[model samples]
Target chain A: MNHNLPVLVLAFPLLAAFAVNLLGKISKKHVAPWTLASLILSAGTSLWVLKDVLQNGKFSYTVGGWMAPYGIELVLDPLSALMLVMVSWVALIATFSALPSIKKEMPGREHLFFSLYLILICGMMGLVITGDAFNLYVLLEITSITTYGLIAMGKGRAPLSSFNYIIMGTIGACFYLLGVGYLYLLTGTLNMADIASRLPALYESPTVATAFCFLIVGVWIKMAFFPLHGWLPNAYTYAPKGASVLVAPLMTKVSVFLMIRIMFSIYSPEYDFLMHLGIKNLVVWAATIAIVGASLIALTQKDFLKMLSYIVVAEVGYMVGGVWLANQEGLTGAIFHILNDSLMTLCFFLVASAIAYRTGSSRIADFRGLFQKMPLTMLALSVGALSVVGVPPTCGFFSKWYLLLGGVEAGQWEFVAALIFSSIVNAVLFYRVFEVAFSHSEEEPSLKFENSRILETSPMMIPPLVVIPVVLLVIGLSAGPLVREVIRLAVPAL
Target chain B: MDAWLFEIIGKFNYWIYVVLMMTGFYAMIRKNNLIKKLLGMNIFQTAIILLYISMGSKVGGKIPILDKEQALAGAVQVADVVNPLPHVLMLTAIVVSVSVTGVALAVALRIYKEYGSIDEDQILERIGKS
Candidate 1:
């Protein structure tokens, strides 16, 4: 209940990561349990923090008791508390699944892998919890740096992937820093709340306008928003499955959260002159092009991971477009879709991991007769695919429903069309994989590649199947309550 | 003499910072060699350090000293004080930036070990062959 819970959520993983690094040097056996325990504890802390935030009002805890605008501060309101719970909880599931996969994919780097993994989790938690602007840039670096470490642990083309990631990520952070410099020059403040308070008086300045553009562009690069997403497909494709599943599911979504905070809270909707700077127009068009362009590109990829990478490009569009609509339904949809997209991508990547584990390949062609060998895995993939396609009763459908409604309310039928178009493209792309998995390959002549690997299942599939369906259900069943709260907070601004 | 040197040093530091930052960015983008790219990253991060230290300067300013005499005298005026806040913040930022560069270099070393070449085009060719 104390505001210290927010700090604890970050501190536990960070300390555990350091301990795990030490323990790992002595004996690798301790790495798995230590990592799991640390992550699960973080998840528990987030849940408790969420409960406290809902029961109480917004609470702030200054790091080192230095007070706001001077000392660093962490705040737990509904938005951040919910994000912490989702991220840490999902991180636990991902870590649970990471164990066997990491052992197989990267046998030598268990200690470094888990330590970097926890560091990344700490960074994301810091990004969500901290109320300081410049501090957010520091936290963003923490996550980005750890992500490079994780990706570098992969086997094939990993270094190059990490290199590309480093280049893009450094540019993103630089853009953010430059923007922070502009804000400081104008307001001479570094705190988000302080900046918000001061920005209104300087709303008409070209510097403020420039600052907002840099900040948005920086966040967009971090999120891998389209046209700036050149680094993503290769990075995700080459990274170890353990790291890919963790990052591909959550990192961009967290960056998107920062973008939303910058847009709504720091910019403060009441500033009429700044609000007229045409950010909404820029976001809407960027999202529109991303949705159409990414879907088209995804349709052409033959590699499994590469296809999923392109799909991520499309998914970013869905979230960004929802935010730019600037209406209740749109914002609610954007918020709720963050959950849906995370779970859906988790399901997708987990299935990709399973397929790679069995066949030692990630090519779409490798999926022929997959259903015969791995029935349960295929079924999980089907659910993930259905969700991606926005099929009814799944979480993805509800997300798209809200997004579409938002678009219509904003009189942007073109965006609604783009959403539907992407969904249809998803159906086509995933169904092709499905059809291949269902049928026997015609290439084999005399002897069939024996289905000797009975079921071809792993210990990793359990958490994903168990949790992903429930997530889908929760999105549908709890949409009313989630939307209500989002409306409550956002209505005043609108 | 101290004031004159401080003015010259403060302005000179900024030019080096901007040039180094640009150099690092150029090498990172222009070169195909992974190790050189990491060297560039180190330079880029060094530029941020210079920026922070520049922000910390105040002409004829003393280091932050807390004593009963100074506090009672109220001698810590804005004009006579260096802003140590940016320096402290920069200290944290420097540690993080170095750690990042360390990891990036580590990854580059691993890449060299695996592919037998740190050149991007050569590595891509090897992967394509595989």
Candidate 2:
């Protein structure tokens, strides 16, 4: 079992999903705690895996003791271990916060929600840890299908949005499958390591190049990179408050991590395929447009959640641009941004869910005088907003700084400018919301304590909100250690 | 005639697959009906399955079941049997695609129940009116 920590982590939550359903049927009240307990166990296994990776370097676990190249293997490197921990950790908090909203939005289907949610965690873990390319496709489908179910749980327009997500997501996954098929055609193997080893001989072939393009495009669509991002805003905006908190922060991010893993691990960072075709420049330019364009689009949204969803689109640009910049700092920035952005988005989305829970609406107009009503919640929201705006002493600022430094090193001044411009745009967008929330109306005075009718949503919701921002601050302050100790180990040699 | 046989017949399977895949892609992207798009997604996935299964075939290859006599006598020649891995992989892919289609149709059903139409334009028009 110790040796099988990789599979155990997946099995713990997966098997527990059914157990949670059983508890929900028999007890109904015991389901949340059971889900949390299993997730905590999963998180513990993730940390164990992380510690082992950091101390002993990478290890691979073959299912049923079967050998690789023929049998499926789960690879636990520092990168995937870190992602496992992050996904589980955030998922744990998201589940805790979910109880309040799930009960409200989906009273009867609570077990079903947890079941799909746990399966999503299982699938994401499989996607991250699996060393085989085709296995990744299967795991990707599992995550996608479960997410569509979770999203459609929303009250209005959610089913439609989820339907849209299904179309795009299926196309993306199938494109990836097609690409894997091409890779198999050239190399006669579907294991990533095996394919990478055999690929150097075929690097100049058009089929290989086409396969690469298919993969990048597929990943881009899944990540919702700017032009391909149409399906994201609606799916996230209209999803049940509980569901968005779970799906928004992790799905696109894990997809981006898979992109990085595909490029760096399955295909070596120094493969030069990116540079040979000047695809790096193309991706970088697209990232630039994505940052600026998505920010502008974000500013136009009056719905608070919709606006943040657009910010998610813009932040996706940051990571994509950083990775495509093709320098060490850029790569580190991209990878680090994945961590920072997930935390930031989680904090903000939780805040959105909490406010929606209390106020019964998520529009900007609903936020009026919110600072007076739920001061602690608003404080948490302020931290998340400032982080998105790249203010210092928050995790977002450090990642943005690294991204800027990366852009400078790469001499991609346009991307650098876009990053800086996005920070300002984010600041303005958040400030606009703040202005609405912090205003003093006739009913709510500037210094009236407890005068407004607003109260904090619940004890459960504030913990994740406060805890996430604190984690953000800690990660921001210890940025050097995290980069030197964790991210660098995960990134392959350039 | 031999050249024609080797070239045309050799590549026609892939050509048919390309046609099938494009039709799926076209319907998925261009069709106004949600159900049609779902159908298109199915076509696209099936085309891919066909492509993989076809790639696993060899003209002279037999079924992948092991011959006990040959196994006892010597190491089996792999080229004598068609590849079985793609078949197994596509089995998984087909299961996944079926799940996707089921979930997609369910969501579409819900959408239709809510909006009274499954046409993309009508849904958009309805939303605009609302």
Candidate 3:
């Protein structure tokens, strides 16, 4: 049972997805509990797997008793084990906040939403653990298709945005497939470890070069890095609040994880940094542009959720840029940021969804006097906002600090400047929202404290909201140990 | 020049796939109608499928099967059989493509119902007005 923990982590949610759909035929009430139980089981197993990997070094599990280099393999190094734990636990927390939103937004479709939701979680779990290049593409599509379905369930303009995402996402997936095909043609193996072993000799070949470009670009498009990010903001913004809360935090961050996997696992740092020096600088520059541009745009948004979407765009820039800095600190910051950014994004989106759930509005103007109306939710938003702005004692600040240190070491002053500028812009953006929420307006007397009792959101939403801020600080205070123990082990030799 | 021509002709399958993929990509980006974009996406995915299938084929190679007696006697030769992995992989790809098409069509149908048109320009106008 201990040996099979990796497969069990994926199996729980996948089986629960089917169970939820079937049981919903009789009653919709079973969907939430079933989904929660499966995610908890999956997350629990993932944590156990992480503990095992940490206690003992890395290990691999072959699917069904078939051997590697032929059958599918699930590799559980510290890196992937950490990612598995992150994706599962984040999905679990997001689901807690999502249930009530789903209940309120689309009442009768609870089972359908959670069914797709659980499958998406399963797909992400599979994605982080699978050792086959082609299997990653399949799991990517599974996550993507379910996301498209979940987003299209929104009331208006959502189907259109989801359709656009399908176009971009399919192109990205196909490009990745084409790259894997090229690798297979050269190495005659589908396993990532086997391909990596064979890649050294073929590094100088033009075919190898083309495959590398295709793979990186494919992943970039999926993660919404810079110019390829056109599909993200709209798809996320227009999605149902429940779906957005889950998808917004996890999707791009998981794709960033894939990029890191490709860079370190399949192709070594020597190949990525030394051989392709020009391309490395080019990517960092692109990340700089992404950061500055997205932050500037984020400052101009009037809608709260739309603003957060652009900030997501900038956070992708941070991770991508950090990786391209091509040093130990940069890579560590990037991997650590994957964990921190996902939690921070989840925190922000949860608060946004909670606000939208009770008020039926996400406009900044509607947030006026929200502090008086819902003090706890506003406090969560404040903590999330400070984290996003890179305030000290929060998880976001430490990752940004590593990123900045990495940028300075690499002498990429532009990237460093861009990171600082984005942080300031984030500070301004959140401050504006806070100012609006705190100010008293005489025109809207209905929102005044005297008119109505101050009420928080539903009981369902409060737990995750409270849990995330504490987790952020806990992760923040322990950043030193986390980086030294897990992340340092995860980073491949430079 | 002749060597270049021979090289191009030798991998004519890949060239054709590149052409198909680009055509589909263009339609996906450049076309106005949502259905046309979906059609382009199909063409793009099909080209990839064909590329993978072509990769699996070998000259004069038989289906990837082993004779029972030959396997027992340890006389099977790898060169005699074509690769089966790519085909199996592409089978999954085809299933994914079909699922994607189904989802895209469903989303397009919803778009048509909501805004009363699937044209990109018209949908934009409607969204703007709304």
Task: Please tell me which predicted candidate would have the highest TM-score against the true structure.
Answer: 3
User: Candidate 2 regions off by >4 Å?
Assistant: A441-454, B1-8
RMSD of each: 3.7, 2.4, 1.8
Model 3 residue-pair collision total = 0
Per-residue lDDT tens digits for candidate 1, residues A1-494, read 66467888888899999989999999999998888888888899898988788778688889998989988888777888888987897788888667778887778778988998999999999898889988998999999999998888888788788888998898788778768767876787788889998999888888888888889889999999999998899999999988998999999899888888888768877766434537676678789999999999999999989999999989999999998888888888888888788888888888888777767678887788788777777878888888889887777888789899999998887789999999999999998889878886556522133344535656655667667766766776676776676434533256
Model 1: residues >4 Å from true position, as ranges? A272-274, A441-454, A485-492, B1-23, B66-68
RMSD of 3: 1.8
> Residue B68 error for model 3, in Å?
1.7
What TM-score against the true chain A does chain A of each candidate get?
0.95, 0.97, 0.97
Q: Model 2 Cα displacement at B45 (Å)?
A: 0.4
TM-score, every prediction: 0.92, 0.97, 0.97
For candidate 1 chain A, which ten residues in a row score worst on lDDT? Answer: A445-454
TM-score of model 1 (CA atoms): 0.92
Q: What does the TM-score come to for chain B in model 2?
A: 0.91
Interface C-alpha RMSD, model 3 = 0.5
C-alpha positional error of residue B33 in candidate 1 after TM-score superposition, expressed in Å: 3.2
Candidate 1 colliding pairs = none
